[model samples]
Target: MQIQDLPYPDPGVPDAHSGPRFLWWLGRNQLGGQLKSLAWGLLHFTSVTGLPFCVGFAIQAVVDRSGARLALSGGLLALCGMLIALGDTFLHRAAVTNWITAAARVQQLLARKTAQLGSALTRRVAAGEIVAVSTGDVEKIGWFVEAVSRFTAAALSVVFVCVALVVYQPALGIVVAVGVPILALAVLPLLPRATRRADFQREKAGRATELASDTVAGLRVLRGIGGEELFLDRYRAASQEVRHAAVRSARMWALISGIQVLLPGLLLITVVWYGVGLARDDRITIGELVTVYSAVMLLSYPLRHFEEIAMAYSFSRPSAKRAARVLSLERATDTAGSLDASVPSGDMHDPATGLLVPAGRLTAVVCGDPDAAGRLAERLGGHAAEEASSDTSVRLGGVPLDELPLDSARTAVLVQDKDPVLLSGTLRELLDVPGSGDITPEEALAAAQCGDVLEALIQGSLDAADPMDARITERGRSLSGGQRQRLALARSLITDPEVLVLDEPTSAVDSHTEARIADGIRSLREGRTTVVFTSSPLLLDLADRVVLVHEGEVAAVGAHRELVHGEPRYRAVVTRETDEEAAASLGEVLDGGVVEGGLRDGVRDGGAAKHDPPKKDSHQSHGSKHGKPTLSDVLNELEEIEETA
Candidate 1:
């Protein structure tokens, strides 16, 4: 592929066994690009090495005092210069292309891994470290990949120059050729110390970067706690350590550079000393002597590629290792599960919690503890905890959800957490996710009560754009909390999954909108199984059945009205009514009024002074059939301790 066709269609599964292995894999995959760079690099360096020969030929022509030879030699010199310029230009372009493509491929791989792992990736790895790997480490790896090909070309050119010189003037060419390799390899001893110092410096700098990031992220907290100056002091100390380490690292590289210059200068002196003796004895001419000296000077430039390659390897090794570690990560949910247990079409059961949600019904679960609700929702969707494999809790159609492949399980169950994120995109793109296509976009939007959201999106645009085409910023930060919630709900509704789990789907909206949303959810998903974890009375009253989860397990299951009168814990969770408040209230509900103690001061029971039950089914949502007053009369507002569940 060409350089422009970057971000490979498939980044391919990596070796990921070790840092070196990962780096090698990257190199092998990009061999085509590397070879392109190598070809251009050969042209550039070979032309450069041939320049000394052109200079030697021109000098001989001038010494001969022949105009024809002088003109011909000058022409050759200019042609060689032209070739050097053309080669250098293309070589650099090709090398930089290699660098960019390598980085893009690595980024794509990391992104795919993150998508596969979902939220589990963040739990297993530090977010800052992940960012550092994608940013700085990726660049380091690309640098090494691009550097390798150039180093190879430079080495090859040096070999050519060595052979040419030895054949041209064996007496003096041998010394210069042998000395060139010595100068190139002379820095090998210093490289270990230099690499160690560089690693130390990088470590210190990374600490400094992380410290600054943490301090800034928590700056508001630090200021509130009156510890801003303390953090500033700590940051200053980290900065100083980084500076010291950088200076130490720079000093080691400077020593290597000094040796490079000094040794080559000594070799030059030796060649000149011997060349002068030969010329005085008329054994070799001035032009040959100049060629030998100039060739050494030209070879010195490419020789630096050796040190550069070594340094590049030292730095990129650790970066490759970090990338491999992230790529190799596997969540417990990512297992080779049974293909036969693919799509769920029956009742969903959680044996561990004793909760069975009948298919084709809306089941509302009232769990007082937010953590328990979250865990249950994830389990219902066939997701495992970040640290370990999930237990045999949830099953679909009598088959364990975990026993099904992740893709099949995810396709079967869609779980929208309390805080559903709205990614940056047009409404059309956002809703264009995997779905059965049974629900239209307009139907989903209406069911989600997003008319006002659609209006805001259109109005917020600079032009009179279509509502579906209007863009939402990242995470919908530009929209209100309720607007984001409704938008996310609409997208989920559009998917129309086999089974859906929504945790506090309407927490951010007002009471009237929440009621409408409840009705919308009921109508929109008439035949699909949906489990809503919420404390809202409006939604609970509309569920086909209400399941009360207490202490992380199902405590009671019944119609909304039955649970309200029969279970005190259920009343406490949904009505926000405390046990003390219940103790101070009138006795057991009696046909609308308190039976023994009579009605509490203002309590009116849907004016029901007679017993009534659902005409066809007593266990059905009493709120839907018995009217709101029977349940609303005793209902109280739940404590708003958590903004979301």
Candidate 2:
């Protein structure tokens, strides 16, 4: 595959059995590219190996005083030089092409695996390992693949030079041929220890990379808890360990390099010693001795590739294995059935949890165990296991979810995970979802109660009022958790699918803001099939029906209020203790006069009547700058009112 045609329409199934096999598979897949590289490599090596022979021939012609022969030798020398130039240029191009295409193919395979596995990928592999594989591992794998042709050509040239020597002078040819293998094998015994050291280095580096990624991801939390120094020290230690391991591995390779130089130098001396004796005894011509000497010296260059190829294999073997392990993973769900002609659009049912979500109604699921809830949510969204078990299926519209085409299943249902990521882009781009849905981007944002989110974006950017055009940093890091959660919710709401499964949709927001979001969602999705997995009383109160998931199965189904009053377990799970505590918390908000007597129930009530609008103040005076009340301005106005009251 060419670099331009990347993301190969299909990277095709990888072998994935072992590293060597995987490498072979990669080579086989790019057979055409490999052949082109091999051809160029052969041309380059042949020209290099032929140069010494041309020089020896020139010396013979000069000694014979044959002018025509001298001219012929000069022409041949020029031809060799031209071939070398052409070969060098084309070889570079071919090697580069091979390297880039191989890397692209591996990258595509990894990307496909990531999409297929979703969040499960991290569960199976370390985030650092994945990152390392995608970056450094990919390059190493491509390097070995690109070196294969060069190594093969070098080996061939070594053999050809040895054969030419034997034809010219048998006594010296035997010594040269025998000594080359000795030089190549001298480093072989050291390779195993070297490989082990390299593996250790790679492992330590992966750990360091993982630590760095985790540290960056939690930097805000670390700062809040004053743990930044602790994490930094830990990362510093990990980096040191990686550095030590790398130095050790480098020492082993350096020893191998020293041997490569020493043995070849000794072998060249032996060949020259034998050739000089043959010339002195009149057993071989002086010109033949020069040819023998030149050939032996030329063979040293190709011999170096033998050691290089060994090193390449050693490094790339582990890299290929890691990449193969990642690519071999298949999604839990089976998507092989081509039965999309008709889909049963009815209530959604999960056999594992025995929870049924009736069509055209909002159902809330409350599970004591969040892990169980997440798993159930996965099944509900058609992410079933590969092998069907008794508890494996979730039926949507009376149809087995796994039977639907992958795309069809996705369009039919959308599960907004608890920690959805907001990719780096403007607000408009973030919300521009793909799939047929009736919900407009504006409608979804409003339904998720994202007024503050919009204001935060505008305040943090040059743009003021146009939230649609405001830029968001990667993963929405600039926003608070609540803001990020709300933005993710809005993105999901934009899809407006036939079935929406939300897992802890309001976990990050305050009770007041969550209440408003709950109210807005209910109103926006009045007639749609929506399932919310949350135990928040505010959200539970808004559901058309509440299902209590106990011990991994449905225990009761009823109205939120009825369950709260009648079921002690449900009450314990969904509500705080005693009315006194609830009353006391509300009293604290009012007595402290925190932000408009803390009557900011407009955040949850979904109505302006509950919380009066902030009176005009200095902050409000500048609100018209953005053609609207910026979120910060509204917040400041409320604080002013609270202080005055």
The numbered model that scores best in TM-score is 1
Q: Give the alpha carbon lDDT tens digit for every residue of 324-410 in model 1.
A: 999998767455464564586899998778899999999999898888898888878876665444455478888777667767777
What candidate 2 gets wrong by more than 4 Å, as runs, is 221-237, 333-335, 338-344, 369-372, 384-390, 402-405, 451-467, 508-516, 578-645
lDDT of 2 by residue, 413-514 (tens): 899988799899999889888845678888888989999888888889985478789999998889987789899998888888889899998877655677
Clashing pairs in 1: none
lDDT of each prediction vs. the true structure?
0.80, 0.79
Specify the poorest-scoring 10-residue window by lDDT in model 1: 636-645
Model 1, TM vs. native: 0.85
TM-scores, all models, native as reference: 0.85, 0.84
